[model samples]
Target: MEQTIPPAESSIVEFKREWTETARETFCAFLNSHGGRVYFGVSDDSSIVGIDKPDEISRTVHSIFKFAIHPSAESYVQTETLKIKDKNVVMVTVLEGSEPPYYVTIKDNNKKGRVCYIRQGSSSYEANDKEIRSLYRKGNPIPYEQRASANQNLTFLTLAEYFKKSNVQFNEGKYQTLGLKDLNGFFTNVGLWLSDQCTAETRVGFFLGNTKASESDGIFTFSGCIIEQFCKIRDLLRNRFGFKNKIEPYTLSSEGYRNEIADYPELAIREALINLFAHRDYSFENAQATVTSFSNRLEFLSFGGLPQGVTKEMMLLGISIPRNKTLADILMRLSAMERYGIGIPTIFASYENFSVKPALVCAHEYIKLDLPRLQQIPSDLTERERAIVSYLKQNGASSRKQLQDFVKVSYGTVINTLRSLEAKKIVVKQGAGRDTKYALTISLR
Candidate 1:
């Protein structure tokens, strides 16, 4: 069906006095937003002003769309040299594009960058990175995993084993069915990732302290099959971390000698790693999924933050809009992912009864989670400092008066102790003024 393009300058229409370079932005805006039309011979006031050399102007319009726009936007746009009020006007009709984030690429002045624009009333507005991501969300018909892989020759030894264990027969037919390779025999990004020939990096670093300035205890990187990488990373993390620091082990059986402990819960760590593999943006191949361990915390960072329309609070509530549904499905069947939506909740649940819960944060290019270490009481603290720590741990948040009474110290002494504890990162003061209360910090150290 043909669109009834309005002539007056508006959100979906633009008027240009000539075949000017500035029309590039308007064309880009139309491609990114809804489809719109531009009148080459029309003035900004919507008056029909005839243009000379209509044929030349049409060629120029075609040239601009072909060479000036990124991703080759010529197919989504059309031009018609028509007569309006006896004046020659070139009407360039642009259609809504399937592959969006359209932008003008200017080679002038050696400047390098894209200038994406969205349609505003009677004008075009520049779009930011977040808006560009939203455009990808709207127009991406093929998932990153389903796209054709650069490497056609690939092998999947570990992937085959996982499939065999799951009782899903592995063969060429299964490859097509699982979307590892297409009917045309081209391997997809999914096949590339699971194959032994995979080149993506997942870097893990164990640091002595909370920042990079501290000496790194150990470092390892993987660039093979995703499943094999997961196994190796799991083993390394278990060997380096999965034992109690200062906390005592819990009784595992009726026998008094049966005790077990881990500084970080296994389930939480498992879910975090799985989430990193299944949800990280594979399209952004340059960005590596990273695991950095500090003495105080464990951090997981993945490419591309929460998917479009998903909020931090929504993710916390176990709502998952997977960026790679096909990859997630394959991993889920292989038992790498227990199921959708359980990863975040299970991690939070594992931290229950602890002073600090895991921190989940979203950014434009990545999402990060900081898992604080379990609380450990230092032995060098003054009696009053230790009392405040114990009291806050037991009673949760407390006022200054409550701490003063519980510690059996002078009012001034209680204030000093609370301040000292706050400085030690053991206690966090909450609220202000008359409603002030102090509670144990989620002990990063």
Candidate 2:
């Protein structure tokens, strides 16, 4: 009897005379695109070439799916035996994978590489970046932080130390749990952010006036481990914008008190900083988070505007859909942030008693939080009253003679300014006779 002939090769069916390493590429291609079948022991020209060891071929095919395809494509594939022309052959069928694009690992010249394959016509071809992105968009969209990084050789010493301080286990065994590595044991993009050799840039700029064009008082660039960068940025902000202590002398019936007032509420600043780090889009390599300090306000800007299905109103209402889930998870585990999605609300609430409200502006590519500085001194105060208030803010309580020396005015001019401030209840007169001094009564609220 003439041997049974297989159908001609097509997009949905492939034939191989024998098992070869390239077979794994075709398997990946099938899984990434539409499902297809590969018939081992069959010639490309639809001729049956029976397998010498059917059982062995089946076992080898199973092994190839197990170790060669990324993200475990074996679950979507199956292998069996068929008898054609009274001879046995191996048949491998791959179903379209739900999560793609699947990649196959190749080894050549003592080096290993990964390539995503897609079925084009009747052949498998390496997918370009655009094709891969389309596949991701069609399937479950993969978070950039969850994708494997190009640099496989990575070290997480900084991350390990951070976890150690937090008493969280961060050894090799917990890499998958922490999202440092994928199922295939490759370093992921999240791991790159936490690595000691991270190259992502984050910047903080202090302008002399109120805009970017103004002379930069200072600029700080942060790189490497993200945790360390957070700490450093926090410290820098604290030093530049922290609160100052103002003493209120005792009155006839009330005891003396001290108040700590800051340019911007410290809690609001911290929440904005944490939100900037947690929700930023890591996929935009050129974009970065920036803290621009102006004379009257501080602006926190980060790339990758609000997440999908989230809006500025939703954020104000305490709704959060994190752009980078793994990064946010790690931050939550470290206790650096809470999962309640209240960071923005907390920032707004911090300024509820203040005259100026915090503003949130979202655009296509970036989001910004503007925090207005505390202005306890009345905006309508006279120039001399403003001068006196500024002087007292810097020098604390001051005698009339000292105020005169500081403001470069006569004692009478100083006394008139002080009396006007006192009349407005913006200044408090302390002590008696020559020991008298004036202090600001500007309430923090």
Candidate 3:
């Protein structure tokens, strides 16, 4: 939906003009601040003038942003047609730039020839020297994870139950002892060590074994830098592997019949999760872990693309290099993991037991584990069986030919499937010879 603008400027910086210097200044201001949207064909007073020639207007706006603006920026423009007073209004939408400090030439000006303009509140103004310095500083802003927030309100009690479950001692005075500077510093201050505040230098956090954070945090979001890495790995796993599964429990039994594949292996799932927790370079200063479930497979992701000197060939051969010694030792003590150095091998073994091969993916920013689906019975059979059961409950009986036609399977396949049903005590035959039919013997939930 198009954002409706009033005939004039509001508190928010929105570009709403047919064509004017003010519109160019507003667009640049929004880019410099929180990226926002600009809509043309609306009066400064917020009336809908609508672009007369949307294509031409679009071309003009693109040229302006591309050629006229200094410190070139990227933006999106969409021309939408709407009905107002039984006439079409062409709406020009401009997305705010990802990078900041965008400006345009104050065309034909008497003063301030090459001055850069920025958004200060609702109005546009020439960026002062201090404002310009601030923008430059923001150009390479500090990552979210490295900076301390005075508002987190976090304490050791935030994850106290986790520590209790692990039987690890959580010294309450550790915060002040380490000179962590605050009760609610960062997970890196307690558990996983990441980069120091502002600089790229890596340092270990206070809590080593994650007595205070969940697997999700240690693997995904301990620090903002690592969290971003987790997101990258997740994307690669989704785009490349295309597997789907759930984070849950399952039991396999061989008492029924042959040829049934287990949904997943217990050992494989644990090893995958543990490998992500144990081996990832949590101090890479800009990486994380990600876990995703899909319809056919499950993905475990690690940050920092692959490791600095590791490749896909090295991974396949069960090569393991421990990244976090302190945290790893603590995990071993808590019995959450082991020192096998064969985590990958264990995961592969689990897949082989389930008659499936999991995929390993390496990208520029992440390493991914992809577990494929195991085929036991046909996927469509569940739906077909459901339809047959409902039909039998309503119609009392069904002939093999009728069932085949209804379910769209071969006659022999339907006969065999029905025979298996009888063996399961779900249905039984009635009548004799050509007059034979099938009826539900007992309802199975």
Candidate 4:
């Protein structure tokens, strides 16, 4: 008799009772991250059930590696068989591949079923377009925008018109200056993005409420030219989130002009939108830059996290490392971006006079900039109303019980306050009965 011990499941270790098509995803994941090993004929509890026909299984694994994995993953994989307690176990070892961003081809899907995967802790997840782009860039230092476009027959009517409007020449020589063409005179991805005939899917959605599940107030999709899309999105955002003026008689002067108060600062919104479009990862086909407006805040979500070595604190300190340098340069030439990397800091400074500050969140694969609404509270509102409004502004929607806990008031008092706020259109009630949650209403005026 023989004894064997198997390792527990971990970031670099996985156990499978048998081979499955899904295992190919894990294989790609291991190749994307640090190398990892997979044990076949093993249980989740480290029990070795053993595999039947180990040699045939090994051959089948080899065939899968040869035919299934894309961009050649065979060099990174090795297989062996070991007998313990008279049971045959197959161990498949996978090393981190030098040519990363590997995808496993699944024919069942579309014609091109190249899906990339990445290992996250103990689980494997499908890599987003941004991650795939990052892997491609990591394997090769050249940025995606600099790469030649697959569609060679591209036109730049929109781009030419933009240059004419900006008082910049749009001759053939300017193409090289703007990164529109490579040395061989082929249209680059940047050229395709700027072309009038380009077909990149960019979209914007305005929801009635804060969350995506809320009813859509408006939805707009942009294609064709990148500059045109940028202008369209900027105009739509400005029209939607722009200042709403409220006229109030001046108390300081008896015969003076009225004060004009805006719902949000225009400079802050401008900087945020510019930063979002300028820094978003263009390699991501599935993900688009999104501007979501809730009642109390607006969120600008862009693909790709902070550039390597740049932190959120550094961003606040005006340190900028643009992921798409060509795009940034174009925007800078168009006068959309300033020379110094002060967009983030300028956004923060825009809200200095307001009670709520803008928030900047950097995640593993994306960045989010949240701008809080500068709503004016009615002077006649009670203390409870002010507290409830403040809570909802900071925490989004909340239930009566939750509000009561935060305000330390009676349940009836909370309910009455909520009703009063709702009556004044300050907050809107969602759902009914116990599932009820109150959210601030859109402060357009």
Candidate 5:
């Protein structure tokens, strides 16, 4: 006959015969680790035979652990009956301990106590001194992933292979090559692996995960809204400013002008991207950096107020502190970052070289960096002067009548404003003949 397996976590079952001390140890291990039901009447081979007196057998097993064991173990014991070989049998069930360190005790070895036991896989092993110490230190914790039994079909191919295909370098050795594998089973069984319990869908959306495994799970993603802003500003640079192909891939190659190059330095842009990526507070879902562009300017807006005990002046003056050290270190090793605490200076220096002051607009929870039109002046001008400058800045050259309309000023007032600006050396006019073009003199310093 096919032997009957014990019922799943049943409070009572059949007991057919005398139980062994090893059987008690197995039940204790179950209680200490994860709770389980033990069928006293069922043989290991699954043949079931009912005990003669179910009540007596239940009391015997109960007294064995509660009063018989040295450190009085607590458990839920239940007695039930089952038919085995056409005879009724008694079953004893033991539930897991709310706390652990459930050891085994025997009548012969009465002096020895605290000899704990735990379940490792299907086998019950004597919990050694070292393992017990580790468990005690850990507070007998249980991971949510393990409790939920996520990724029941966990395969290294599912996670590690993807990294290899992504052009990431990894060791070809045994599973040890993957740091995840090297971590004790404790880490893996606890849901450290990419499992259904901790799926990377939305949680990964706001944060940027490391391409490298040691850093963090690769579930983190740069926010979609932040990337949307980057594209918006980049698009404006191309369409309106006539800055054809201005947003180039990040590279060390020398392109554009030999000396003039692009207005923004490659290092400066790199630092900006890195700073925006690294220093951003991942906890703030609404604070990703936002970039925008207008006719001749590109603006980078980022969430996060300035660092503590610092000011807009200090930020422009090149003071910075990183909030995420682990995330930053992994990115730097992959060449995604240049240096820490130096991005602000690098960005400011990029504009300084162009002789145009980069404006910083600090808000309570956000910072808006405004890049004015390429030919616009760094002005402390009144509203009227600003209007004239903004208008003439884009047109290259404008007639007196055009300037009057653009600046919304009277003919006499327009002439005086232009001459006053020219005298200050902030704006200049050039041309041998009447074909003069007025532009703001680049003097960022």
Candidate 6:
């Protein structure tokens, strides 16, 4: 029995006269490529000649896929016999190989090697060295940026605006360049994160007192693309505190100036926000980054602890390794963060003058950073006096000369400030006369 074929050969569809050893090469090709279908008993032209033993051919195809192809692609390949005008054509359907560089087992150059094939145009041929290496890279562990997104239909208005504001060109032409889409025209996970359809959010809760013991305050959530959320959260966190002006005490001369102090250091808050976004585990759908602002403290909670073998001590020492390199790079391009190890150190430095330092609880599942509210800085400190106390807090015990030079003040002024701070219990004097040195009583955070 025979019937006229309906169409010609194409990239995803192929015609074969019979099931031969060469058919394995094409099977390997379909697995290596985006997957395809091969119809046997069909000629190169739109012609079909029925196979005499359809049962035997089907059995042979299954046996080859099960035993011959590398990594056993039998699970992804299936064969069926179809009736075309009284003629039977055996059709084999193949799905894209989960593990790539699918090849037929063979011997080449006196060594056991693989015979790899890839689809090009309407033909399948042996893959070159470059193509084979590429296939090997697409292996058991795929990078997050390369994985296809579950949602294909996505919007990027927010992302486009962010890119534009950063003066970076963002268009369909840059999809692959920016790793927003894969080579097969599917949106990648990176695209999903940058798109308006992103599911991650930032949650903030306002609680009473220094704890969340009783919930009567309020809560706010920021969503959409992580970029937009970052901006919104940054602004919200920034505006929560106001400034205070400090002046020198008992200064008869015009040596005093206004010292603007903030409840929380601006740099510390910014760094915490950036770390929350760039390093926290984005893979976990059950948790999100959050902040809790209480009357006496601010706490930041994030999912996923320090990476393997990393500890809290190392983090405090400014050792940082980003969990997502690609996202980190993108954020850096936007000038959103610093490259070196300044973030954590800056945060710790902001609390340098406090007796009770900030606390960090690092666990396997999550990390919690607790920053005590503004408490150490006395409102009456003059600009020069505050500078002296800050220097002592950071540099430990310092001589009168060191303090005078650091604050660019007269030697007598430095002595008076140190005496005043010592009387206030903020600074402690050591030794006597020329051996005198002052140190902050408050421990570094």
lDDT of each: 0.78, 0.79, 0.52, 0.77, 0.50, 0.75
> What are the per-residue Cα lDDT tens digits for candidate 2 across 316-377?
99988888788888888888888758999999999999789999999977999999878544
User: For candidate 1, what is the lDDT?
Assistant: 0.78
**Candidate 5 lDDT by residue in tens digits, 106-146:** 44465355467777765766787556644553444432222
Q: Please provide TM-scores, in order, for all candidate models, with all chains considered together.
A: 0.67, 0.55, 0.37, 0.63, 0.34, 0.50
Candidate 4: minimum summed lDDT over ten consecutive residues — where? 244-253
lDDT of 5 at 251: 18
Model 4 residue 84 CA deviation (Å) reads 5.8
Model 1's TM-score against the true structure: 0.67
lDDT of 3: 0.52
Extract clashing residue pairs from model 1: none
Error of 2 at 400 (Å): 17
Between candidates 4 and 6, the TM-score winner: 4
- C-alpha lDDT of residue 192 in model 4: 81
lDDT of 6 by residue, 53-118 (tens): 888988988887888888898899888888886788988888999898888865344425668899
Q: Model 3, 174-274: lDDT tens per residue? A: 54333233335444322323112222222111111112231111122233222222223333332222123221111112221112223356456667766
Q: What's the CA error at residue 172 for candidate 3, in Å?
A: 2.4
Q: State which candidate has the highest lDDT.
A: 2
Q: Give lDDT for model 4.
A: 0.77
Candidate 1 weakest ten by summed lDDT: 250-259
Worst 10 residues of 6 by lDDT: 244-253
- What lDDT is obtained when candidate 2 is compared to the true structure? 0.79
Off by over 4 Å in 1: 1-17, 39-50, 62-91, 101-137, 161-169, 243-260, 308-314, 375-445
- Measured by TM-score, the strongest candidate is 1
- Candidate no. 2 TM-score: 0.55
